[model samples]
Target: MAGRKRRTLTAPARIVLCLLLAGISGYFLYHCALDVLTTFQLKEQIAQNKSQISELEDEQTALQEQKEKLQDPEYLKYMVRGKYLVTKDGEQVFKLPTTQDDS
Candidate 1:
């Protein structure tokens, strides 16, 4: 093996080798860029989902508090009287009219 001369590539063979290496590198680079973009989009989606979850949790807490308040009979009566305008027996209800302006 020591006595044998080393073999070298010709110009055409070196060109083909370089092109092959470049093609492989380009293929891997394209997939890597796609993966990076997908990761960024998924992270944005996760952040949006997290904010939505927090908003829903806050709404749930508020609804729970409202539910607890509604369980009280006095608060329930007050709400019915104020919102539904329910009057007790032999009670008179009054209404005020508002004027509207047209353009």
Candidate 2:
């Protein structure tokens, strides 16, 4: 037709089209990269929490064992004697030589 010339993509139009597409794709990729980074950070946090929880659980088990041991009268007496160095009546406590040398 006389009025309509053509509807083809010229060189400049193609360049602009390519640039637009690149800009849009770059934005999308940037957002996705941010998400990936956030996910990695969250995973690291979760791993740290898991390790802390494991350590706490181990400490709890040790404390429970200690609690059970403390419930025994003999263990309590032994702890007291070890700490206070007190001996039974009519028992002599000899002072041992010091292992440290006073150089």
Candidate 3:
């Protein structure tokens, strides 16, 4: 009968290999979770930014209309009188009373 030797890894080598595999798997899992979180955050940020952009565009349009209105002398005079209580020369200023009661 011939004798055969069995091949086996040492305890330290096995432990090291196990720790290495664990470390690699942990790193992969961590990065995968982080990637998901980052993607979610980016999507949220994009939606928020889009909303902000829409609001800014609306404001810009309103401002443009206001600018056009201000370019007209009659519109400017009306705005100044309504907003600032200002009157032109020889113009009579009248104040209207509000009918709403303050509770």
**Top-lDDT candidate index:** 1
- Cα lDDT for residue 21, candidate 2: 100
Q: Cα RMSD (Å) per model?
A: 3.0, 4.3, 3.3
TM-score of 1: 0.88
What Cα-based lDDT does every candidate model obtain?
0.97, 0.94, 0.95
Q: Which residue pairs show collisions in model 2?
A: none
- lDDT tens digits by residue: candidate 1, 28-69: 999999999999999999999999999999999999999999
Q: Best candidate, TM-score-wise?
A: 1
lDDT of candidate 2 vs native?
0.94
Give me candidate 3's TM-score against the actual structure. 0.75
Across residues 1-103, which tens digit of lDDT does each residue of candidate 3 receive? 2688888999999999999999999999999999999999999999999999999999999999989999999998888899899987898888888798789
Candidate 1 clashing pairs? Answer: none
Q: After the best TM-score superposition of candidate 2, give how far the Cα of residue 65 lies from its true spot, in angstroms.
A: 0.9
Q: In terms of TM-score, how similar is model 2 to the real structure?
A: 0.72
Judged by lDDT against the true structure, how good is candidate 3?
Answer: 0.95
- List, in order, the clash count of every candidate structure: 0, 0, 0
